[model samples]
Target: MKETDIKELNERIQKESAFVDMLNLEMHKVIIGQKHMLESMLIGLLSNGHILLEGVPGLAKTLAIKSLARTIEAKYSRIQFTPDLLPADLLGTMVYSQKKEEFQVKKGPIFANFILADEINRSPAKVQSALLEAMQEKQITIGENTYSLDEPFLVMATQNPLEQEGTYPLPEAQVDRFMLKVIINYPTKDEEKHIIRENITGAFPETKAIIKPTDILKARGIVREVYLDEKIENYITDIVFATRYPAENKLKKFDGMISYGGSPRASINLALAAKAFAFIKRRGYVIPEDIRAVAYDVMRHRIGLTYEAEAENITTEDIISEILNTVEVP
Candidate 1:
């Protein structure tokens, strides 16, 4: 808490986070744009949390995750979620061995260090829960055996917009399991020009591994050590509380606009994500700016909008903007 301690921590974080820039350089080799998506993925990786990427097809959502996996020296698996996907298919099922006269555990792709659940909303609820459970527990139970997942295990699930046909919307509770829900946008005109030139000329770049899985595991611990003062904690709580009771927080206009507010997990993720954001910035202490940077992604899926808000074309983005503008920053 002292000034000298902060100085020491800052130096240490600066040294620890030096690899971040190199990792970013490697990712940009293949990815043309979507800097926000890449940064959110890094925050999730550093905070030991899962991410949900929602965008229309061909926006590089899947490519970004693939490029990230390529940059890290870890196991990666991409599972395509379909309407007929079963729980056993995601979490390994028991297999009978004739020679051994017993059932052998055949682990599913969930055992990998990094998982890409492609088109997650295409699957049924049971299949979705199977993946979500593994994401939360960080383990899988096959038959009678419980297998702990490998360290630095992170899941990046991509889903098409719910308006897409034949898509099953994830349940509220199920969706809440994700730490961050990022909405990807199309590239800018200049960025798109480069994208077209690269593809047309067959000049797509390949990302090389810059860090190992252990490096990420170590960084996660350091991210937690990033200082969060009481003022910042109070700021996080107040923002989350305002989502529940807008009238009490000086945002009375949103009384009926929000049917439900964020849960306790929202506050927790917000704090953790803010700390991680600070770490990514190579800082040892968290600031209000860090919290603001991640608030939209952390709370977007958690807030439930009312029919009145929808009728007025009010979105969670609008409510969050008001909360940030009205809530006094620490």
Candidate 2:
């Protein structure tokens, strides 16, 4: 883009995205810390992608989503995934009506704009698969009738890490549908102190509807319009390719550490997430820093580590760090 156009876009985005700060402030009123997780959630929302959150209990993972929904005035639903959960339980089943004597379609919690699938890993595979269509297709079929989900649809699923003993791990194919997988950590000591003060004093804040779904759609369009030079595109491609063929990318040390590299979807999500990151910062163009900020969350879950690496105490984050450090920036 020319200097004038870039300047205009910058000003326009800055004006339209004023709500970003408001969203942050409102969430902070309720949530203590986890800035990374909060920003990742915004990225997922702006990019129109589903997010999977892995964190232990008391991390405010549930409260964060609720506060976000409250801020946007979007419909919210929380589906508790359990061992006995069935496909029909989540996607809804046909209900027999006494008066009409015909089966009526009773929609499940998936109809909401913001969905919190608590303990998603606790449910069986069959029950989990029920979300595949809704998450990917953005629509659900009920008794031969299809129902389209509301715009700005975002599914934030959380899994408990400490109690994975009886949990059914999400399959790779199922996991790929998510745009990013965020691993949330606990708050800092000072932040925890603030949380304690807030809880004790009953000083919780509410988020208002700063922007509507149409406004979000407009912002998403703007995010796509954010200029990404060819060099940056190549940079993203190289990073993803390294995940698949580490040796070829001059990272031979990671040969056996990774069983498989990130898929094509990983590349797409990485680029989209970078664009969203840039937009979040009110930038008119994407830079290497934008990609770096979101690379771990976008690729961590997508990167399948080998058993050998796990035995050696290596992790997907390690592989991602090496790849990013080795890959030349644009």
Candidate 3:
């Protein structure tokens, strides 16, 4: 891209991305901190990708999703996944209406614009797949008919990192559907102090809706238009290919550590997420920093670790750090 073109695009993006600040302000009215989590949510929202949040309880995962839904003026639904959660429960089921003497399609909570699948791992595989299918297909099938989900539909599924008992963990293939798997941490001491004061005083701030659903739908289009230079594209591919062929990419130490590398979807999501991250930063073109900022969340769940790596207490984060540190930046 020419210098003039980048400047023009930058101006256009700056204008279109103005609402981001307003939306963030409104969200912060209710949410105390977790800037990274909130930013990841915006990236997922703009990229039109579902997210998997891993954290212990009381990290305000549900509250974050709810606050985002409220700020965007979208319908929100929270479905608690349990052992008995059936596929039909997530997706609508057909009911026999005695009065009409016919079957009626009663949509489930999945019909909403934003879904908070709380404790998604607690549910059985059937229930988990049902939600994942809706996430991937963006539609539901009930009876003999198909219903398309509403526009700007997003699923923010949460998993309890501290729990493993009786939880049906998502398979790697199923987990791959999510674009980003963010690991949320406890708030800082200062943030926690505010949280406690707000809770004890019963002074929970309310989030006001700032942007319409159409605004988000429109912003998503602009996010895709963000420039991805050839060098950046190569950089993304190099990062992903390193995961697949570590030894071939100067990452020989990881040759036996990784059981399998990320799939093609990982590459696709990586590019898309970098673009979205650039848009979030109000930049017309993607920079190397944008890709690096989102690389960990985008590739963490996609990469599979070998048993040796796990037994040695190595994590995907460590591998990604090494890859990023070793890979040449554009």
Writing each residue's lDDT as its tens digit, candidate 3 over 1-330 gives 688887888898899899899988988888899999999999999999999999999999889999999998999999999999899988989999999999998999999989999999999999999999899999888988999999899999999989899999999999999999999999999999999999999988889888899999999998888899899999999999999999999998888999989899998999999999999899999999999999999999999999989999989999999999999998
- What does candidate 2's lDDT look like per residue over 1-330, in tens digits? 788988888898898778889888888877878999999999999999999999888899889898888888888999999999888888888999999999998888888889999999999988888887789988888889988899899999988778978899999989999999999988899998998888899867766676676778889899888888899989999999999999899999888888888899998999999999999999988999999999999999998888899999998999999998999987
Overall lDDT per candidate, in order of appearance: 0.92, 0.89, 0.93
Lowest lDDT 10-mer window, candidate 3? 1-10
* lDDT agreement of model 1 with the native: 0.92
RMSD of each: 1.2, 1.3, 1.1
**What value does the lDDT take at residue 48 in candidate 1?**
93
- Please provide, for model 1 over 6-110, each residue's C-alpha lDDT reduced to its tens digit, 9 standing for 90 to 100: 898899899999989999999888888899999999999999999999888888876777788878888888999999988888888989999999899999999
Order of candidates by TM-score, top first?
3, 1, 2
TM-score per prediction, in order, is 0.97, 0.97, 0.98
Would you list the clashing residue pairs of candidate 1?
Answer: none
After TM-score superposition, what is the CA distance of residue 159 in candidate 1 from its true location, in Å?
A: 1.7
Candidate 3 residue spans exceeding 4 A from truth:
1-5
- Candidate 2's displacement at residue 112, Å, is 0.2
Clash list (residue pairs), candidate 2: none
